[model samples]
Target: MRVAVFSFPGWGHLRPLLPLVRELLDRGHEVSVVVAERFAAAAADTGARVLTYPSRFPAPVPEVRTAEDLAQVVVAYYEEAFAALPAAWAAFADDPPDLVVEDALSTAASGLVADRAGCPVVRAFPGFAGNDEVPLNGSEPEPGSPDLDAEHPAIAAFVRGLPDRLARLGVGEDAVARVRARPPRANLVFVPAAFQPRVECFDGSFAFVGPQPPADPPPTGWSPPADGSPVVLVSLGTSSNDNPGFFLACGEAFAGTGWRVVMTTAGHLDGATAAAMPPEVELHAWLDHHAVLPHAAVVVCQAGAGSLMDAFGHGVPVVVVPQQPDARVMARHVAALGLGRCLEGPVSGADVRDAVLAVAADAGVAAAVAALRSAIGSAGGAARAADVVERVAAATPTDGGSQSAWR
Candidate 1:
């Protein structure tokens, strides 16, 4: 079978799908990954055809301060997807893919492409999966809250522009709308079912097959301190690491303590700032999370899905500082599940220290983390995700729709 996988720009988005790509290739299926030029090498490394598109969706996207700014960022991402569609069509116009797998965050663009190709699609959620009870993309305003798009004009414009984008792709709005109205043949979520919010609300249409570890993970040149002090790993993910304040706070929080701190700056810190950080805090431009996670007693980070999964997969608790809406949702779940503590309002060295110490000592949090780790291991990761894709592909008719495999 021939499969086409569509991805969003960030590494956080593309990384989770690589294991599935490798799995398909190993199973003797032809695979093509649609990605921006920036991510071509990573996709190509999987031994699949790399379809490149011109995307101005900047990596380390500029920090968004308001809903309007965030809406504009959303518009930019959709526009990037719009640019990718023509290239995808040009490649498969005559002989299309048997199946299409797309990032759940990118469903609109990729689903429209699948509609034009007459192929079945499988949506992969690297983060939360939403339903009637809790919506993912967007939903009506809550109670007396204002309508999102109405209050945010850019979002309103984005909603209005959808039809035109479909028209340009030679796909009717109804065809794309139909794809959205019904769930895909399979929904692959790269997190354990235990981690999901309102897990009972999601039906068999979703498969919560936890994250895949990297095929060739970077070498861990890191080692624990000879003094045997506890280690704390601090990060703010790739895109949002521009906040020097958070890193500075972490440095102060662990200074003169028995806990040693390891931080990945992602090139966000200047020489002066790096020099200013206390000696107890070690800084690196980049480090394989695998290098630090096993030795880590606790993880302090901005609540990103990938980071959270890595921490939980290692059975280490976390202290989360959320930077966005989706992250906030993840933080809430972390707190509710007893997996970690969520920090709110203005953060300080004392606050970071307190939260990390609290979670690290809490026996309940450790037990919860251990149980989630077990659940993630049992969730089957990439192998099960591949099984779902193959089943969906085999069951789906040539018209690119299926009802038999709703898993």
Candidate 2:
């Protein structure tokens, strides 16, 4: 069988998709991963054919000073991603694929050709909120409840722009009509089914594929102390580490403590930022997450699903400081599930140590982590996902125009 996988630019988005792709390759299917010119080599690590497209997105402007700025940043991601679709199709002119597995956030699979090729398209939801329409981050003054305002600035922009973007994609004025009329063959959600406990509804073509990490974790450049001074990993994810003040605060908090802190400041920070004389701080641009999770006593991060899920699988407690919409929602679940702790606002390193210890000290937290890990282990994960792909490839009917969400 021939399979084509499409991934977005960021590591969070790319990470979850890799395990599933690698599973397909292990099953002996011919696979090709379509990615940006910058990420082709990274995608090729799975041993599949790497198909590159010229990505127009700038080095992710991860610093969100306000709601309006985040709105603009998101729109830019879509525009650049949208412009690359036709070219992606042209790259596959010779032998069209049997199936296309794509990032749920990307609309590339909607290009008229892939459907015309009579192939099934399955979307992989890597972050929080899979295919749901209702926002899950309602933990504040409740946009519908109390602590938060009744406004979602980011979602509103995309909703308003939907008509214009659809027209630009040649979906016509009735694009929303088409969305209502035609969804996709199936959606393969990569997170566990229990994380989202919501009252609202969404398109129902989604599946759960559990949490999966690369079979091989990377080797870290630094090692923990032999004396075992509780090691904690402090990361703001790769993109969100643009804020220097946050790192400064962490530097102050983790200083002079028995805890050994390995900080991934990302490429956004300068070396001078670490000059505050904290001999215990180890800073680097990136760490091979798969390589380091086993030794981690706790993880402090931005609450993205990839990091949270990895920690959960390893029975490592987490301290979540969400930086975006889904991040906040996911953090709520981490706390509610008793698997970790949640920090509501801007975080300090003192807050990091306290939260990490607070969550790690609870014996029930360890039990919950072990329980959830057991649940995830039975999710039929990568092997089941491979089975579904093979089944779809065999059953795909010729002639694609309009169909049900589940084909």
TM-score per candidate:
0.89, 0.81
lDDT (C-alpha) at residue 253 in model 1:
76
How do the residues 109-209 of candidate 2 rate in per-residue lDDT, one tens digit apiece? 33333564556777676754433354434243235322222245655665677667656555454433443355556666666666654523434455566
Per residue, candidate 1 scores C-alpha lDDT tens digits across 1-407 of: 99999998888889889999999999999999999888999999999999998888866665465556667776776677666777887787876888899987667667766787777788898887776786772233334432234446776776698778767767777876676775677799888888887778787878889987433335777888989989999999988788887898789878888789999989989988888888889898899888788889999888888999999988899999987545766787789999999997788988998888999999999999999998987888889999999888877256335343544
Clashing pairs in 2: 140-147, 140-148, 141-146, 141-147, 141-148, 142-145, 142-146, 142-147, 142-148
After superposing candidate 2 on the true structure, give the runs of residues whose Cα lies further than 4 Å from its correct spot. Answer: 58-74, 109-111, 132-180, 199-205, 213-217, 396-407
Error of 2 at 301 (Å): 0.2
Give the Cα-based TM-score of candidate 1 against the true structure: 0.89
lDDT per model vs. reference: 0.82, 0.69
